[model samples]
Target: MTDVIVGAALVRAGKLLAQQRAWPERHAGQWELPGGRVEPGESEEDALARECREELDVAVSVGGRVGADVPLGPAKVLRIYAAGLVSPGDEPRAVEHSAVRWLGLDDLDDLDWLPADRVLLPAVRTLLAGSFSSLSTAQDGL
Candidate 1:
């Protein structure tokens, strides 16, 4: 099976953005990170932005991959990104979600994340220790 690369964005400010799955979906009723399938010819950054807009109806500033659950060949790969809302009106619109909520990290395990994302839970916690995303070393000059 070809591994699908999906973007997983965790909105900060003491809460992780989660969305309830629509009925008949693979993970229906479960709360998962808001994102979508990466499109062809699109960079991960662009894909992340587009996915956020389509899934949550919000604009987000794409950040680094704080965590990634990439299985060996044929297994699915989920790239977890550290992103922030671009505006004050960043609340979810539920275009693709049944419901959305701001959840604390401690409540993460309570939600039913996809298998790959569940594996990345630990890494996500670690990244949360720092603020937002990391600045590129190359950008230290600026």
Candidate 2:
């Protein structure tokens, strides 16, 4: 069976949270979403929440799946899910990453993303676009 690695596409206030890798020389300095391998017997959502807490020092509320599964290698697959900070005002610090940034739509393509993460850009774009559209509609009504 293929191992599952979950990624959190955590968005807030029209921005998506991205983290820069700090190690594994080949991938260091490249950006990717916050997440890690799902432990055996743990649900994807649970693993995502745990990863967020461990990697970002913040709690996240996992939402729906964001994109299709991406192959990592012969034995591992990547899955991304929509998520948001449990406390909207909470700031995510780079606990294990080199740095963390909140990226706007225009900034997404500028970063050098890890190969697996690059595949999900379109889905992430749609997620952020939907967020902005909803915010715009709500503001218009107000």
Candidate 3:
């Protein structure tokens, strides 16, 4: 069976969170979503939440799947999901990455994303657009 790696498209306000890889000379400095492998017997959502806590020191509420499965070599595949902070006021820290940034729609394209993550931009774009609209609606109600 193929191993599944889950990525969190963690969004807040009108931005999406991205992390920069810190190690492995080949992938260093490249950006990607915060996530890790889904362990045996753990549901994808549970794994994602756990990963966020481990990698970002934040609690996330996993939502629906965001994009298609991206094949990673022969035995692994990447799946992304929409997620949000359990406490909207909470900030995420980069525990495992070199750095973390919240990228707006305009900022997404410029980052040097990891190969698997680059392909998911369209779906992430759609997700962020929706987030922007929701933020606008909420602000307008104020």
The candidate that achieves the highest lDDT relative to the unseen native structure: 2
Q: In model 1, what lDDT does residue 15 have?
A: 64
Candidate with the greatest TM-score versus the true structure: 2
Write the candidate numbers in order of decreasing lDDT.
2, 3, 1
Which of the two candidates, 2 or 3, achieves a greater TM-score against the reference? 2
Model 3, C-alpha of 49: deviation from truth (Å): 0.5
- Clash pairs for candidate 3: none
Give the candidate order by descending TM-score.
2, 3, 1
State the weakest 10-residue window (summed lDDT) of model 2. Answer: 131-140
lDDT scores in order: 0.71, 0.97, 0.96
Q: How far is candidate 2 from the true structure (C-alpha RMSD, Å)?
A: 0.7
Worst 10 residues of 1 by lDDT: 129-138
lDDT (Cα, tens digit) per residue for candidate 2, span 1-142: 8999999999998899999999999999999999999999999999999999999999999999998999999999999999999999899999999999999999999999999999999999999999989888999999
Weakest 10 consecutive residues of candidate 3 by summed lDDT? 88-97
Please state the error at residue 6 of candidate 3 in Å. 0.2
lDDT of 3 by residue, 41-117 (tens): 99999999999999999999999999899999899999999999999999999998999999999999999999999
Please give the distance, in angstroms, between residue 28's alpha carbon in candidate 1 and its true position after superposition: 0.5
The list of candidate 1 runs beyond 4 A from truth reads 1-4, 72-75, 132-142
